[model samples]
Target: MKKLLILVFLTLPMIAFAQTKPYLSIADAERITAAAEAKAKAEGWNVVIAILDDGGHLISLKRMDGVQIGSIDVAQAKAKSAVYFKRSTKIFEDVMKGEGGSRIATLPNAVGVEGGLPIFKDGIIVGSIGISGVTSAQDGIIAEAGVKGY
Candidate 1:
């Protein structure tokens, strides 16, 4: 029993690691960014795009020609929020503004806003993409454009 317990403890981390998959790669992030940039240019909608890894770290970002400089930070925050929270930023935005707004906002790394959309690969959410410099609806559209290839 003692030997079995020791073996189980030793292999638990490995087992947990195997359950999760790395669905988003650097190439995917770049490609998604490129697609988003192209769509923005074609539509004449300048914006800032931010892509985050599954762990909510920055993967890629693009500031378009005419986008306001402030959008970059907002874009990153939105992406981080989605990736870290594992849900849509829009949902958090609404929940945070509700009766328990303050309590909801206090969650670590939680961001309550729009413009963040999870990037799913093979039905698994591996990362998220965020777009700024336009209305939330437009941000959703831009992010969705990038997600199509995935």
Candidate 2:
């Protein structure tokens, strides 16, 4: 019984530690944003960026010069939708649009809109990226630049 208690105490910390998840720090987000923003600025596209955790929670977000105000919420929603859905939001829109797309778009937490992409690291999905303020295609390109860090 004493040995069992000792083993439990020794192993508890390890178990607890494993339960803690690794998330991208703010600095990491800034680096991604800066890199992506620079690329977008080169093309003269104002963009709003969003980063979300694996659990689809917003971690950090930014809007560059001249981006629209509404782009902020839409960008975050697109990112969260991507993280939770685990695929490009564009895919859902493409799959569900027309015949069933509109219906699927109505699903809860389904932002089948656009400008959402999963952030992968070492083959695991660590988070998601969303961009807005420009065309959805342009937003995609900007987001792609940020994902290079992964």
Cα lDDT of model 2 by residue, 1-150, tens digit = 999999999999999888454566677777778877887889999989998878888788888878889999989988888888788888876877667567876777778766888887656677898998998878888888887754
lDDT for each residue of candidate 1 in 1-150, tens digit (9 for 90 to 100): 999999999999999888466578889999999888777777889999999888888888899887898999999988988887778788887887788787767787676777888887777779999999988877877887887755
lDDT of 1 at 54: 86
Global lDDT of each model? 0.84, 0.82
- Reference-based TM-score of each model: 0.77, 0.83
TM-score, prediction 1: 0.77
What lDDT does candidate 1 reach at residue 88?
76
Q: Which residue ranges in model 1 land beyond 4 Å of their true spot?
A: 1-20
Model 1 residue 111 distance off true place after TM-score fit, in angstroms: 2.2
Report residue 42 deviation for candidate 2 (angstroms).
Answer: 1.1
